[model samples]
Target chain A: MSNTTALPISALHERVEAIFRKAGLNAIQSGALARVITAGERDACKSHGIYRIEGTLRTVKAGKVKPDAVPELVLQEGSAIVRVNAKCGFANPAFELGVPALADRARACGLAALVINDCTHFSALWPEVEALTEQGLAGLVMCPSYSTVAPTGGNKPLLGTNPIAFGWPRMGKSPYVFDFATSVAARGEIELHRRAGKPLPEGWAIDADGNPTTDPEAALAGAMLPFGGHKGSAIGTMVELLAGIMIGDLTSPEVLEYLGTTTLAPPHGELILAFSPQAFSAGRPGDPFARAETLFEQIAGQGARLPSQRRYAARARSEAEGIVLTAAEIEQLDRLLALGLDAVS
Target chain B: MSNTTALPISALHERVEAIFRKAGLNAIQSGALARVITAGERDACKSHGIYRIEGTLRTVKAGKVKPDAVPELVLQEGSAIVRVNAKCGFANPAFELGVPALADRARACGLAALVINDCTHFSALWPEVEALTEQGLAGLVMCPSYSTVAPTGGNKPLLGTNPIAFGWPRMGKSPYVFDFATSVAARGEIELHRRAGKPLPEGWAIDADGNPTTDPEAALAGAMLPFGGHKGSAIGTMVELLAGIMIGDLTSPEVLEYLGTTTLAPPHGELILAFSPQAFSAGRPGDPFARAETLFEQIAGQGARLPSQRRYAARARSEAEGIVLTAAEIEQLDRLLALGLDAVS
Candidate 1:
């Protein structure tokens, strides 16, 4: 893992796209995958960015994920409920197609719910929700991952550190976004710590015997704790029910098969909700966008940092000065580039 | 405080109504107050039931709550957004009037949000959501109380252990209702332990210095832990933002001024959401009610207990025989009965 000098984001995206294209991804699919990976890095989500390249490539090679598959829309209930059978993975055509339709339905219905099943892994939710808000629609998205944590007081892991993201539209300011895993800490964080040979924070995980453990390896062998304890457990349970059971995918037992295991294969189910304030309100006669902006400004002034502020700030920095990547991560990118991968195709 | 023997449910309601009437509540207001209190006990929510009578009387006497106040409807948009101002106290009337209208709007708009502000405590949210489901609508309700618990890793209590309830209508069965407080344990549980001289459960509360304590009395002097830790905290925080700030109520700090130091009085904000399944689907042609019943039976067979099963069961028992009350609680009822209150009108 020798360090390599940083490269411009464009260069990185091109290289990543080229790699996917080399692996037989069509131009559109490669471009979509590259955009998602690059966005993760731009937002400082290193674990979800190029760090995932090796695993993703392995999945592609193993045929666990299709490189050029398109999502099929199964059911549409006008602006209320839309179901998309992700023929491939979540990040490719599934997200690209489902998001815009969800936004349109939200505009028509005031609130819209989209179910994405059998889709590939969606790395970061913020970009999707943020994109919705940018289109004047508030977004709430949740995805139940492979089970990696136990219910409170339960010895066996039964639920994923399910993540939820909410984005609120603003007028002049960036949309307010809140996104976090339902666990005390995401399993990815534990995995990262394990990679770096670091101990986990107290209360974040429990060992095989259900005793608290700081050793990332031990936690990986055991279960992560819920975020707030019972409340978090309840939410995790709710997510399992809503995002998993409700969407017709793996239940508690089935999800457990993927625990402590890493693969680029798509998780089975994800739920997305998009809402339009105008659908519920008399469309912003006085500029609702301005009102939203004022609300965020007021919240920030009151010492409350809006969720996603840090990510948005990072994105701005990346756009201005280019994305920052570790030398090692850059080397990995270089290796892929030298292999003649054309990400953008 | 001395223990009062239990009495029949009818007697308890009569006593509570008498107390409110004597305290200057109008007939309808007294009846509504009695209904909520009696329902709390009926549903096994002892904390929100008869226990709140004395506190309510004191607040009314002190002019802290308006006994005869009425909520004013402020705005209505396609039933998607309905706003109500709780003149001063009286949350019941607003709930009674606004919920049905919102449900109807949801029937038309697919989803609806009802925001109520500046109201005295509205106890036991399950009943309200159940009522919405009875009208064939799904409901999600959230209430953010005044600050009662500190944020995780923060000493000062900065947020309320907000509660949220969700109810979905089944095709043929009782609506699935899930109602829970965001705290590790309800505030009432702590009070119960304090009165009974019992140790609280581990992980339920933390002392003033943020150390876990099982001593109820010490916990009373300290802070309740968020349910699931950070996950529950996140939900509570979301409730505060959605039901409190977004709905235009005073923040936790301003709300604390109105609620007393004890767990007795809490100034809180409540938000109710209603969604119509019919709006999503024309639903099968005939027997919409029958469809719900069938759905419930199937779910029940699958080991899914309907939310608020206890309440429904108790209601059935009360309807067939009579509502049961503890001897001590009954004695308290008799004391109130001595005021010569009329059960109806």
Candidate 2:
């Protein structure tokens, strides 16, 4: 692959599929994993895209995740709340099978929840949330990962850089979506800055001794701070309670301690909630999408850039002009492809 | 009432109850409203405590809110999602009526939502969420007020402080709960700082020209900043979508624009979501409360204070030692009690 050569989404997806297939994943698993990674790439999320492939492959080979594992329905709360046990497999496939059921159930019940437990969730949560939003429903997703952040005014890392995602449906336009980690700076982002030899902004992290520092290296060696201080830490705790306790999976810190850095894609948990506007808003005369669009316009009129606006802009630009990875990145991809995982090549 | 006198919770409740009863509320309504206000005062929440009595009186006097109005069930989606129309009255009464019903329904359905519309929510949201929490359910409450905070990167006020409250149930312990505004500093806090001749904190609010300022007066005249910039703004938007659009009530900016500083409450909306732990977590061997306690301990071990820990400490001290109101607060209470509307007084 040439550094200047633009790869279509289809091309990247195929390459990723080939890699997964080489790692013994079935077509369904390969396809599901490829779809998320491709979207990450298409949206210029390099950290979650090409950067994750090697780790995922290593996990699959090490038997930390069952490549052939299938998700099973464990419980149902009325017709609205459904729980799926992912059985120590990758989460994307479980979500693929569960989200449609979630949407259909929400349409009938007005609100629905798909609680997925015991899965290794290595991808961004926005794709599943946006899927619900694109179906003209409001979506909210919560997930807790390995512990990496210290609580407010505390030195030890006691919580994950938990991520929460939200999506609102819009008719004839892209759904409004946002996904963010609870930490002031995601560990991956700090690592990225360190790789690029860039100085971090203040208030992002602290030194190993718990003193605030602007050095990304020092912060990574120590612990990341929660965004917005105490408030963000509280939200992170809420995420752990909802996705961990509610779903009957190990909380973030518990997972890290349970695994002890020996595994990848170990059983974690996630929760996806969807709401149907039609069933709830009997008093509204116009479409709910129109109302949501009006609110979006109100913010836009204030000259504020919304999350979806930035994402869509980047996505559109990437889809048309293609993403440009560095020379080193292309070489790394080539090396990964040559690691006995490219039977087709 | 002497300013120097330390008042018991029962005494404060009695006075608040008398004021509400005098203003035409029935015993049930007066009791519910007094309970919340007393909690605020006991917790040292000066912003929502005695300070709000004047505004509540003004709203009642101006006919913006009907003191005698009652909330009635308007819509239900199976047993899980319910909507209540407040008949243009205060929200505390509506929650007082709906929460018991909500808890019952949530236990049956595993999850339930109570949407309140056509109401003036003049008090803190924590009370209603705490109600559901006490019943061994996870509670989430969302309420959007008149626009007072600016969208990130935009100077104009396009969203309210928009507090979202969450509570996690713990058996035989104070349920962990927190309520936070999307804005870094709420409007009422800025007013308090201005009155005390105190400087505003950095990153709290911007001047009229959208420039960051430490002067409380300048920030008060301008728009308040969201707590975590774009992230906070997005959360505020989520609250509006869930509370306003889904509940068929006016969104934040729309409400402020329609009222134009002419009214109090102005027919706001709120959404309360409750989830039953037993229904969601089938695999847990022991009580979910035990797991929750462990998580709380983990944080405490890290020297991180959880929300309920702090609140319960304050509540205990207040109950034992009582609270002392300032001379100005006492005078304001005196005037409020002497108003012509005070029939009970």
**Most DockQ-accurate candidate:** 2
Candidate models: Cα lDDT each? 0.68, 0.81
Stretch of 10 with least lDDT, candidate 1 chain B: B280-289
Q: What range of 10 consecutive residues in model 2 chain A has the weakest lDDT sum?
A: A336-345
Candidate 1 global lDDT: 0.68
Error of 2 at A167 (Å): 0.2
- Candidate 2, which segments miss by more than 4 Å at Cα? A75-77, A262-266, A318-345, B1-3, B75-79, B284-287, B321-335, B342-345
Please give, for residues B1-345, the per-residue lDDT of candidate 1 as tens digits: 234344467776887888787767877668878988887876667777877777776666656667777777755432346666666776776777577667766766566677666677757787787888788776778887767676655544556777788776665555677788887787778988999999998988888776789999888778887776554655666666566655556555556766655434555557787756554333223343343444344334434344567777877676665666667667666675554333211
Q: How well is candidate 2 docked (DockQ)?
A: 0.65
Q: Each model's TM-score, in the order given? A: 0.78, 0.94
